[model samples]
Target: MPRLMLTDEHWSKLRTILLEDRVYDKPEHRQTMEGILYRMRVGCPWQDLPDTFGLWNTIFRRFLLWTRKGILQRLFKKLISEPDFEWIFIDGSIVKAHQHSAGASSKYDEAIGKSKGGNTSKIHLAVDSYGLPIEFTITGGQPHDSKAAKPLIDMLPYANYIIADKGYDSEAIREQVRGRNSIPNIPRKSNSKVGNDDIDWCLYKYRHLVENTFEKLKKYRAIATRYDKLKANYESMVALACIMCWLPM
Candidate 1:
């Protein structure tokens, strides 16, 4: 209950994963990880992280190290090694960018961009039947869902069916889903004469699973809005949230 996020139960499981490589260990490791989760929950500036967690700057540096090394991303992928794939849902949602997240070095790739809602970033996510996150990507708000469909689906394992909204109604996307030996459950556009006669209406309702996953992840304040200036750092933040979703399982 001290200013920390991970419960003892959660820490036990996460400890096993974080230390699995045995590459590095320290007495402060648990506190460091807690600090990371704490920041994710509150979206506070590193220097503002509560003192009960200790030396905010120290914790922030460790997080930056892990983010740079792709440790968090790899850990998330490891937790999702086996997912409920019988039916998978994919979709995207946009997050507004905080003014504090601006002014990043131009050398780093950034995801935030101008949109009808001002600056924003979109999170493209895929979820299993149980609404657990499987894979996700970040992009500027202006890009269409189809631009991210291929790489996102490519990272996933084979599934019996792939579900999406009318935004992904393109034949190319459907064919890509077919390439995975999966049936596509995308509804056609309103303007198109071709109807959704083939769509599995019953199962398509479950497409809300991905939306729910996004909803849950966004509950963590850091994820609800874009604060990280670098795309990789933002992705690492999202990966940690996804790991939290899988951890409860």
Candidate 2:
């Protein structure tokens, strides 16, 4: 069998969340889940999955059903029910969109846009103080970070502070963060009239935690580059990666 990413203990916790309906046998579902993780980690086409994990098509179909049902997002939500809300860090990162990721027929935006890097997608992420992901949204690469900031901030659980880089520096964003009852720790641009002296440089240093979270997530090749034609599929891939981060905690 291929090396499994989740241990028995980790799988035990996740199994409760993923297979709550019990449509498939525990062992079979576990194997198929491993198969899905294998594809996500290695960034391979479904057909390349090895026989040890069973038929590749079966795994792919199962993944599609779960994505449609929002099962992966639910799993991530369950894992993070009681997050460390003392400090929430928000940031956005751009991922190069592979040629294969294009060609969606749906009217909905696929979160893919043509930029200098060709086609690209942006992942807007919010992580807790410990550098663990709390929530995220995908957008076209051309969307400004501040553009996605409000929605991402609105979805966060109660937090005392929200931190981000200067790219997200804007009065409207600061107002949105304040509306959530959280102080915005974003640094202002040098050209801005506001002075930096009032900003908490000490707490601002922890802003790296969100960047580090992005680094860890990008370690999964599937997340480092977009390959799913539909935004829903890409969102599911991201939710699964976030769940993996919470598994060992």
Candidate 3:
């Protein structure tokens, strides 16, 4: 078989969650998962998958079923049940969407939009103190960072301080953060009446952690540029990437 991404220990942790109530061969399940990971890592078309992982169509269909069931998202949530919430960092990044990512059925928004960069999608992430991603939301690239701030903040697990850059410098965002009883460490815009005195310059330095998280996430070619026509599929790709980050911790 092609080199596997998950070691025995890692597979042990995931098998229960991934295989629950599934009536397939356990060993084949691992191979199917590794095949999916290979596609995500290499950003290859499903038809390009190697023979060792079984029929490409089977693996691709399983991925679609899992995405529809939210299995990957649930697994990520389960792994992050116990998180370090002292300092939460939030940020958004734009990913250029490949031409193939367009032309999806219109049942749901694909989260792709036309921008200066051509078709694009924005991923808004919330990371914990250790720079581990806890939650994220996908939007059209045209939306401002402040537009996603409230929803991202709302998903956070009880953080002591929420750190962000000036893009999230709106009073409404700060008030929302304050409403959650978390201190807002976002820097105020220069012309704003609010002074930077209340800002925690020290903790603000750690805001780079979220940027770093984005860097690591974008390392996966599939994530660097959108390939899936469906937003749910792309979101599952991201959830899997986030879970991989936690696996080593």
Q: TM-scores of all models? A: 0.95, 0.96, 0.96
- Looking at model 2, the pairs that clash are none
Best candidate, lDDT-wise?
Answer: 2
Question: Model 2: runs farther than 4 Å from truth?
Answer: 21-26
* Deviation in Å, model 2, residue 54 alpha carbon: 0.7
Clashing pairs in model 3, backbone N/Cα/C closer than 3 A = none
Candidate 2 residue-wise lDDT, 166-247, digit = tens: 9998999988888878898889999998878768999999988988888889999999999899999999999999999999
Clashing pairs in 1: none
lDDT of 3 at 156: 87
Q: After superposition on all CA atoms, how large is the RMSD of candidate 2?
A: 1.3
lDDT of residue 192 for candidate 3: 84
lDDT of 1 by residue, 1-249 (tens): 556667888777767777885537687888888888888999988888878777998998888889888889888887875678899899999899998888897775598878777888999999988889888889888889988788899988889999999988899999999988999999999898988789889998888788888889999999998888888889999999999988767
Q: Which one wins by lDDT: 1 or 3? A: 3
lDDT of 2: 0.89
| Global lDDT of each candidate | 0.87, 0.89, 0.89
